[model samples]
Target: MAGFDIGEKWPFALAAILMGATFFIHLVAGGRQAVRPLLADSGTVPLDARMTLYYAWHVVSIWLAFATLIFFLAAFRPEFEAIAWANGVMAAAFGILAVVVTVLKRLPAAMLPQWVLFLPVAGLAIWGAIR
Candidate 1:
């Protein structure tokens, strides 16, 4: 918030880019290794790009999104003047698109954490609208 303009093009875009980069990294990293925290022991099957793509792009994209929320809350919280209809549109778009696509696809329930479906993208939307 000190030097950032949350509602402005530069700071918001920078944050979004950082979020995107984080998502991409998680996708390529095959969150399986990353997800090991939840597993009982090591030894897991190798996954191809498709696996990487889903976990990384599909899953990590949603998971790391919280960072984007936090970044905005910390960086752009001061920019209330910037929070407007455009930001609202972005929030709705992102939250809806991701959740809708995943649900409509009927993605296999087994491959994901049970609560993964309930992640609060609405929080991101709220953060976006606030900033």
Candidate 2:
């Protein structure tokens, strides 16, 4: 990885921050500022099984965002090519997690998670961009 740019992966962290900020903005604009509903449940599905699946999705996304943070570090910190390897693995992990959650809960592969989940995803994406 000679000649690899340290700045290549920077800006991820900024993307993450923007994501979290966007959620707050949307929540305030929508006039639904309750923490419990935003965080715990959204009342979208009726079945307990569905709810569990839904929550599982949220949990995975949360973790993915955290992993994305690590990748972002590579960009900002400019580690060796090993950072690329770590980020690549994280990317695969996110994909697998997303697919598994979608299939287990009978959710469409392209489906969007509830608002709560968006915040973290946005945060991760933004963080990636800024880092």
Candidate 3:
């Protein structure tokens, strides 16, 4: 906590909090709402497909957790800024993809509101990086 100056790097701190919250929501709520159902489909969904999707889900979980830690570290250590930028770009990409998919698939925006969660985290990370 010695070099953790929230006043100077509040954006990164805020980004970390948001990312952390998002990670937990994805892990817990998504597991219950999405993964559980996917796993429960014994006959309809193929085992290989289900397992592949499950692997991808955990990959995302790991990425979110890593980014959260990197953002927290970047809030205190200037050296981690590059990593923050990388994570920010990835976050922005995720947000943009959500919007693109919603529009292209003719799905309701509210149905795939990932952009609402990710874009702000991207914005905060970029803001903190350049601050």
Which stretches of candidate 3 lie above 4 Å from their native place?
Answer: 1-4
> Clash number for model 2?
18
Return the clash pairs for model 1, or none.
Answer: 27-56
Could you arrange the candidates by lDDT from highest to lowest? 3, 2, 1
Give, for candidate 3, the lowest lDDT window spanning 10 residues.
1-10
lDDT (10s digit) by residue, model 1, range 26-74: 5555456555442333345445543563465455467456555554554
lDDT of 2 by residue, 1-131 (tens): 55445455544444434444543453454234333453455466456855565576556446545544554455555452354344444444555666677778998754623334443444444454444
| Count of clashes, each model | 1, 18, 0
Q: What's the true lDDT of residue 9 in model 1?
A: 32
lDDT of 3 by residue, 9-100 (tens): 98888999999999998999889988999999987988999999999999999999999999999988888888998899999999999999
Per-residue error at 48 for model 1, in Å? 22
Give candidate 2 misplaced runs (Cα > 4 Å). Answer: 6-35, 38-70, 76-80, 110-131
Instruction: Evaluate model 2: give its lDDT.
Output: 0.49
Per-prediction TM-score to the true structure, in the order listed: 0.31, 0.35, 0.93
